[model samples]
Target chain A: MIDLLYFAWVRERIGLPRERVETGAATVAELVEELRAREERYALAFADLSSLRVALDQELAEFDAPLAGVREVAFFPPMTGG
Target chain B: MRVLVQAAPFDFGAEAQAFADGAAGAGAIVTFTGLVRDLSGALTAMEIEHYPGMTERAIAAIAEEARQRWHLIDALAIHRHGRLRPAEPIMMVATAAVHRAEAFAAAEFLMDYLKSRAPFWKKEVTAQGADWVAARDADEAALGRW
Candidate 1:
């Protein structure tokens, strides 16, 4: 199980802040592909990988990175915190 | 103690005092408070939106990364969400270390990471309409240099 989080327009597109996802994917890219396959909403949210940032297990990572042993994956627009 | 995310405005003096008050044998406390500037030539009220739980976790990770990369004794990062007025405090970072160099360097590092790595997004509302501002190349370059 992994806690998937969405922020900003991604959250608006998915209509969810967070969700518990069960997956058998081997990499972050595969997981995103699975999510995109689920519905048009997910497809729209994950359409452009360049516009989004990903964190695995609370650490920033590339989309193609492996997801093994990861407990959390968060997706958000490029940060504007500071 | 290391991270806090909220929508309410924060008092800089009080927060710095509190952080300094909690420090143990620290000689320097460097703080950075970012204000909502009416972007040069732009008049807009910005609204910051964020993922509740994930935002905190991402910032904590950035703080932890800063701790690992610097000689720091303590660090605190607090950011505001929701609507914010021009010139209001948007975020603050305090880094306490044994000397001024570490404190200052860590403070800068923290802000750089916070700007590029955190999960908060901002939308500027002007007389025209609300438009979400995308991340700039400068921010990416800042993160890259680290």
Candidate 2:
């Protein structure tokens, strides 16, 4: 099992801050697709990948990044930090 | 270099003084503090959320970059997460160098990186409702300069 985390609006939509997911996906994009199929909230939150950012194992990564040994994944909207 | 990510409010004056005092070999010290702007009085409060482990790591990486590009004696970055009010200090970056130009440039570089690359999100709450502040394209473009 891997840890899946959400922040900001993604957290609001998914209604959970974090979860343990057991998946067979090979890439982050495939994992996202798996999540989208699980619930409508995930589908809605992930409708637009351009507006979202993803982190794999605490590092920023692309959707097509390999998830073979990744332990944690976080999804969130574009950061507005200062 | 030092990076602090906390939820409690920080004292800008004391922190600035401390940073300045600790830079023994520096001739110039610069500090920049970001305040919550409540323009038009529509904003009641601001809520900042951040990724726990990534927040500190991202900030430290930015500080490291600044140190490499400039002749800095020391540098510190402090950012707060959670509820903040209008005019409250949201974050501060302090840089010390042998000259004013290096200090100023490093501080600006740190600010630009913090605004774009850091994994922090802010939401503005007003009497009408609340909304997540959109990330400005200008911020992303600003990073390309360095």
Predicted model with the maximum TM-score = 2
After superposition on all C-alphas, the RMSD of every candidate to the true structure, in Å, is 2.8, 0.8
**The CA-based lDDT of model 1 is what?**
0.87
Residue B10 CA error for candidate 2 (Å)? 1.1
lDDT of 2 at B72: 92
Over B1-81, each residue of candidate 2 has an lDDT whose tens digit, in order, gives 879999999999999998988999999999999999988788999999999999999999989989988979999999999
TM-score of 2: 0.98
TM-score of chain B of 1: 0.94
**True interface contacts retained by model 2:** 0.87
Candidate with maximal lDDT: 2
Give candidate 2's whole-model lDDT.
0.95
lDDT by residue (A1-82, candidate 2, tens digit) is 9999999999999999999989999999999999999989999999999999999999999999999999999999888888
Misplaced by over 4 Å in model 2 are none
Q: What digit string (tens of lDDT, one per residue) describes model 1 on residues A1-82? A: 9989887888889999889989999998999999999999999999999988888876779998998889989888888769
